[model samples]
Structures are given as C-alpha cells and as structure tokens.
Target chain A: MSKGWDPGLVLSWTVAVIVAGAFCWLLGDVFWNGLGRVNWQFLTEAPRDAGRSGGIGPIIVSTMLILLVCMAASLPLGVGAAIYLSEFTDSEVGFGRMIRRSLEVLSGVPSIVFGLFGSAFFCIYLGLGFSILAGGLTLACMVLPILIRATEEGFRSVPSEYRLGGAALGMSRTRRLLYLSFPAALPSVVVGFVLGLGRAIAETAALIFTSGYVDRMPSSLFDSGRALSIHIFDTSMNVSGGEAQAYGTAVVLVFTLLSINLAASWITDRWLYRESIGS
Target chain B: MFQFSSDTILFGVLRLCAIAAGSVLLLVFVFLVVESWPALSNVGLVRFFSDESWHPAGENGLFNLLPMLWGTLFVTAGSVLIATPLGIFSAIFCHYYAPSWMARVYRRLIELLAGIPSVVYGLWGLVVLVPLIRELQPPGPSLLAGIVILTLMILPTIALMADAAISNVPKQYLHSAAALGLSRWSTIIGVVVPAARSGLFAGVILGTGRAIGETMAILMVCGNVVQTPSSLFDPIRTLTANIALEMAYALNDHRSALFFSGLLLLLLIIVLASLAETVRVRGEVNV
Candidate 1:
C-alpha cells in the first residue's frame, strides 16, 4: 500500500499553478500599464480612439441598464418557476425533477446560442432592433435557468418544519410561501441575482447580436448600447492598436467578477450562519 | 379585481413575467425558425447537412457542417484526454491526502476557477497560450492551443465534481480495506473508484458539455479554419467557434443551418446532461 504523496501529483499541480500564475502576471502587467489609461476621461469619454472621441461612460451606463432590464425580465419568472416546481409539484412522479434537470441544461447552454435566438426573435420579430431592450430580453432567457435552479435550491433548503407548522395552523399555501418561504430563501435568491448580474455584465456574444454593439451611450431602452464586455470585444476585434484599452477593460471586468463573487459568498455565509441560530 | 390599483397592477405585471417562462422555449424555437426559414426553403435540408464548404459570402453553395462539427469534436476529445486524468487524480489527492484546512481553501480555489468568465480565459489565452503554442509550432491558434486552454478552463468543474464523487466512497470501505491488509493504492483503485465511478463519469460528462459548447475562448485561439486537424498542432475551428465567427455575417440557408447547429448543441447537452443528472444523484451534494 502506498503511503506517501505522489511526486507526479505534485508535478502536475505545480504546472497548473504555474499556468495560473502566468495569468496573474498578465493581470499585474495590466495594472502597471493599463492603470494610466483608466482615468476620469477614460471613464466618462465615449470610446474616442476606437469610436474616435471618447470615455467609457456610455458602456458602463449601458451595462447597468441591461442588468436592470434583464433582472426585471428574468427574476419574477425564474422565482415563479422555482416555486411552482419546489412547492407545487409532486416530486414522487419526477415532474419537478425533469423540469429541474432541464433548468440545469439551460444553465450550461453557451450564451452564444441565446444570442442567436435573441437576434432572430427580439431584433426582428419584436421589432426591437439592435436596442438595449432586445439585448436585455435575450439575456433574460439566458439567466432564467440559473435563477430558477438557485431559487429552488434555496427554497428547498428551508426546513419542511416551517411549512408544516404553518400548515398545521391552517395557513394557506400561498400565504406560507409569500410570508415564510420567500424570506428564508431571500439570501439565496440574492446570491442568484449576484450571479446573474456578473453574467450579464460580462456578456458579450449575446449582446453583440441583440444589442447591436453601439459605442455611444443611450438615453432610452429603444436605443442601441454597448456594455463593458462588448467594449472589450470591440476593442479586441475592431481596434487596430487598442491593446492598452483592452487590458484596461479586462482589469475592470475581472475586478467586477471577483468582487461580486466575494460579496455573494459573504452574504451567503452570513445569512446561513444567522439562519442556523434559534429563530 | 381593482385592475387599476397599484398592488393589482404590480401582480398583473409579475404574473405576466412569470408566465413568460413557459414562452421562453417557444420564443427560442420560433425566433430561430423565423430567422433561418429563408435559408432553409432555399436550400433543401439534405445538401445543407451533406455538404462541407463554409463560404458564407460566396454564391449558390452553402451546406455541410462536416468541418465545424469535426473541429468541435476534435477539440472536445482533446480536452477530455487532457482534463480527465489530471482532474480525477487531483480530486483523489485532495480527498485522501490534503489536510483539512487546505482542503477547504483548495475547494474555494476550484470554485473561483469555475466562476471566471469565458472571455477572461480567452484574454489570458490570447496573451499567453497563443504565444506558447506559436513558439512550438509553425503558427499559433492550433488545436493544441485550444485543447490546453479548455483543459485549464474545465479543471475546476471536473476537480470539484470528482472530489464529491471520491468523498462519497464511504470511509468504512477504506478502513475495512486497511483492516484486510490491502495497500492504500489497491483500496483506491479497487474499492473507491469503482464504487464512485458514476459520480466521476458525471463530472467528466459535465466537462464534456462545457468543452463542446465553449465559444469565446475557441473563437480567440482555435485558428478559424475549416479543416481536419492531422495533429494537435493544426489550427482548426469548432462548431461553436464557427457559429460565433460566422453567425453575425451569415445569410439565408446559411442562417437556418446555423440554428440547426444550435439544435445540434441542444441535443448534445440533453444527452450528456441527462447522464449528469444520474451522476448528480450518485455524488454527494456540493454547492
């Protein structure tokens, strides 16, 4: 019987760590060189060098706008689907399980497929064109599966005692769900939103077709807009010498992802810890 | 019903949004049909599936997924070959050898790795991976590059899933094997892996789904060529990368065929994901 650590394991692990280390090195390079490019004008100016006159003001605003629109579209629907499956369905027959599995499949679907569907549906069918509304609506579909699964898992984690006790007191199903179940799962649902937000903010391919990749800031939902992800994509693809801007964009995007994930983890831990105490 | 009241109106809107979930799939099917219809009717479905040429802007000839399909499959198989052994081994090591404090930290690292966006991975690949590939080969963006990139990308998911599977191999089984005077190596290969294969298989399949559908990273690294790669060093395109690169510019039946590619993707995920569901049942719960 072998008792010691495998040298092969250590070697393979070191190789992976070194590769990951290279990634961090690139990040450092970006900060060292790319920081100077990310100033007040850089933030406020519309992509001038690429668009020929500029700041990232429009892209940031557009990204936030898309997030709001996407959440508005996906949240209620996903939560409802989660609730209908978790609370309403008879899991013994596998109906809830089937739907749950489908939701996971949906989560794993590449966003590009969602983008293709969006471009065809919202951009042409709905006459929304390459507008912010079209982009957000497309992403709404993309996030729905994740939201539903997370919400369901959150609701499932709530002990049946709470619901059984409510029922024993003759409370209605709807009443118990709204008053008790929703609050208990509120933390998890928030985690889902955070995940969805990070996804939406980083999304590029989906927005490319539906949102139509405009560089300028928009004042209305009907107007086309670009997000930070699209800005990075545009810089990477279209700009001839905007590697500086691309690195700057990557730093912003990476930081946004890391911070949001951290915040969600903190919220999740804090809520679970609080929930465990006598309540 | 107090239709004009704020609460009633709010409920009405929320209900509409909620109902739209059912419409979500319908919306996808209908939209793909609408966009792809012109192309479909023009070129009968047979030529579309049978042919392999990929000139979207060219005249009269638009059919065949052989190249892109081949490409996607190539990279996927390559990634599977790379990730499976490394990931399974890492999972086993973490489960058996890691100290408790280190296990939690390592697990978190895996989670963080999974959370990084595809585009960021593409960025890192472009800056680092491409150059490394180019140095060894004639030019960059070979299938090798894509494979290595994908292996790294899927490691965290595969590792975490494998660890869950390994952990599910009951402690008593290990102790009993030890009691029987069996070696640690024998216990793992004989007792642990065989017992938890379903979970490990599920994790591998999940990684496959990820590798097959990966778009952005392949778009950046896989040399956008429609050719059968003879070696790992050859630049090739994947079905996903093809769709991403060509979808925006495609017209007519080319468009329909692209949606068909999506349908194909849906079908692929459906199969593996169904298997993954069974695997999920076998593996212990993980967040």
Candidate 2:
C-alpha cells in the first residue's frame, strides 16, 4: 500500500525549513541593510564623530590588531596544552581530566564574567589599562579552551603507528611530537586558529571593558581601540547617528566570520578527504 | 645530550601551559569572589539574594537580585521553551529526512549560524526583531524579543547536539523496529528517540547554559529594564546585562553588587554545566 501522508516527515521538514528560513532571513536582512554602506572609504578611514560619521577605518585596524595579539598569545598556550594532554599526560586520568573539566567550565563562563576578569587582571593587575594588550589577553583566555580541545582532537587523530615508528627510530619524545605528530595535526590546529579567529573577531563584552572602546587607530598594543562588534553595540546603544555605520560594521563582521568558518570547513574537509584516501 | 635537554625544556613548557590553562578557571572564581566580597559583606549575603529591588544607587543601596534574577530566568526559560522542540525536530530532519548533500549543507549553514557573533544577533534583534515586536505590540524591546533572539542563537547548539544524539542511536534498534513492521516515523519516535533521550536531555541542558549565559543579544532586545517582567511584552534586564550596563559607573556597594551578581551567575552556570556534564557522562556509560 502506498504510504499515506506521514505527519512526522511533514513535521520534521517544517521544523528544518523554519529554522533554515529564519537563518536566511537574518543574513539577508543584515546584507540588505548593510551592503550599501560598505565601501573602500568605510574600510580605510577612521571614525570622525564617535563612529557616528566617517568610515570605520580605525575600527578595522583596531579589530585586526586585537586579533593579532589574541592569536599570538593563545596559539602557543593552546597548542602546547593540547600537545601536553595528548602526548605527555594520561588524559583519561586525574590531572588531565581535571584540566579538561576546567576547560569545559571556563568555556561555559559568560562573556560578561570574562569582562570582569579581564578588567581586574589584565587592565588593572597587569597595569595594561584599557589597551589592546589587555583585550587580547582576555580573548586569549576565552579562546584557549576551544583551541586546546580542537588541537587535542587533531593530535588524537594522528595514527599511533607514527608514534611507534618514531620510537623505533630512537627519536626523543620532543623530536617525535615536533616532526611527526605536530605536522600531522597542523591542519586541525589551523582549524582551531580559524575558529578562534572567528570568536576573537565576534567578541564584544570581553573587549568592552578591557579595550576601552576608543574609536582611534591604535599606535601600539598599549593603546585602546574599538572593535567592530563593540562599535555595533556602541553606535546602536549610545550614539544617535551611527546606526547605518553599525549595520555596515555588522555586515563586515558577519562576512569576516563567515569566511573564516568556510575556510575552516574547507581545510578540515580537505584533510579528512586525504585522510580517508590514505587510509 | 643537547637534543635531550631541549626536549625536556619543550615538554616543561607545554606542561606549564597546560597547568596555566587549568588554573585560569580557579583564578576567575577567586577574582570574582574577591571583588564581590565587598558587596557581600556590606549588604550581607542574605539581603543580596533575597531583596526584590536592584537599586544599587538608591539611599538604601538595595542589591535584591530577585528582579534581575527572575528576568534572566524568565528570558532563559522562554528561550528554552521555544528552542527545544524546534531544534530537536530540526535535528531529526537533518539526520533522517534530508538527503546526504542537503544534510551536509544544512550542517555547514548551522555552523555558520553559530559562528555569527552574538553582537550581530543583537544588532539584528534591535533593527529587525524589535521593530517587528513593536509593530505587534508597542515598545519594541521586550521579553518576547529577547526570547526570540536567544532561541535563534541557541538553535545550532541544540540541533547539533540532538543530531549527534540521534545519529548515535544503535542501528540494530532501527532494524528491529523495521522487522516488526513499524513505519520509519513510528520507529524513530518509539525506538530511536527513546534510546537517545538522555543524550537529547544533555543537549537541551547545554543549550540552556548557552541561552542563560547569552548577554549582548538579549541585552540589546530585552529593553534592559530593571523591574521584573510582568508579561512577555515587558522589558527586563538580565544579570549579565545588569553588570555590563552598570559596571562602568558603579562604585563601592554598586560595584560590589555587580561583582556579587557575577558570582551568582557563576554559580548558576556551574550548576547547569555540571548537570549537562553528568547527563553526558551517564549517557556515555549507558552506551
């Protein structure tokens, strides 16, 4: 007998379509409202009146600077921690589990709390003031767990035979990890970086207190700078005339994040395809 | 000998990084508690949690968190209610109904959605969702706007988690259901979903954490009013929002009160996260 109309299928399809439609609507609305406002000037010129007039040049520079600092700080810490977990420690037992659990807990801490912590430690305790350095460090802390987790997954995916092969060659543990394991996990680690980049770009609250929301081009890491995300919040919340610029910044932010995520997936997909073929 | 020493140094560095990463969480707790103690001691812990008003600047300097706490709970609960069913169904569709290519695209799109910054979502809520709400009801920013934005934000988390849970259901269970002449829909409902219940529950819990912790998005659309919301249309402030909004200017008791609010949020998140972890562990054990 021909299957009558399946309500479950209908319901599931409806749900999927609704969610997908909402996503499309959101992206479309941002683009529709934001695309026209973006231009070369907007990308290069500094804000004139509290980001209410002129282009978001300084904001772009500030965002990139903060991201650069964040990546520089977090990459070593996160990847090293991941390597330690995967290679040196018995990750299934005591201290390793505690580390993993702590990462989990830290990841779940709200951005606002991180804002407070960032202000307390980096801005005040470290005497960085409301500077790019403090903001970047805060973001680094925020991203460390994600990076460690992703990089650890990469390290885990390396075949054990590589370890054995290295050992048979009388390679030291460091030699094995540096040349064999790390290279193999480099793609995954890159993926982690891209993910962290996306996060660092999107972060607002963590940077708001630490970064001090200055609309000027930063001369050094010590200088305060406004990020696109924080710019969006500031314009919409405090400023009266920066609404259009906020949309433009949002579009730029969304596009940047989307591109990073796409690059990440492409990298992971290529790696996985190669992995499967090699296997 | 040089190589060995270098290797030792490298390993030590890695171990140090790992230890530092682990200690960050403890440091966060310590800093928050230390900062929050001024308010805790000044107002006394009993009044902080028990009071209804959140006027840190008033003559009495009330730190009653019930209003903001209730606001957070109300918005979070509302978001959970909307997101859970939709996300679960979306997950089911992704796993079962969609073709392989469609599933792949959907997964990528969901990830993209997840990657979009919370601030963008807030901007969208302010420009689109808030006005939409205002058209239907005066005063654009309200609990409803917050809930809707939060529901959208958390969908990827719940959907992905549920999709994983659904995918992990044993193939044998489906095969057995098929052998019993149960339809695909019935089998999923009667067997597959039931088997994946704990995993789904854990997913929902994780989604709850995400929703509750969400600040900027809800902050933008939720009107940021300090009073407890009498209805979904009423504007409200969350604990996160309260701190974000007031931390810049707050001093003494007000500042400590914000820190104390942070402490309370930390506690709430810790509870939710541990519960999610417990459920996930239990699910793993069951499997």
lDDT of 2 at B238: 93
Clashes of 1: 11
Task: Candidate 1: list runs displaced more than 4 Å.
Answer: A1-36, A51-54, A92-95, B1-19, B181-183, B278-287
Query: What overall lDDT, based on C-alpha atoms, would model 2 receive against the true structure?
Result: 0.89
Candidate 1: residue B91 lDDT (0-100): 77
Predicted candidate 2 versus true structure: per-residue lDDT over A1-279, tens digit per residue: 158767788998888889999999999989999999999988998887778778898888889989999999999989989999988778768999999989998988988899999998899888999999999899999999889999999999899999999999999888899899988888889999989898889899888799988888899989999998999999987898778989999999998987898899899889866974785
Number of the top lDDT candidate: 2
TM-score of 2: 0.97
**Tens-digit lDDT track for model 2 on B1-287?**
98889888998999999999999999999999998888788899899777766778855887788888888999899899889999889888888789989988988888888888999899889988999999999898999999999999998988888889898899999889989998878887899888999878987888888888888898899999888888889999999998888989888888888888888888888998899878877878888
Which DockQ values do the candidates obtain, in the order shown? Answer: 0.37, 0.78
Question: Pairs clashing in candidate 2?
Answer: B51-B64
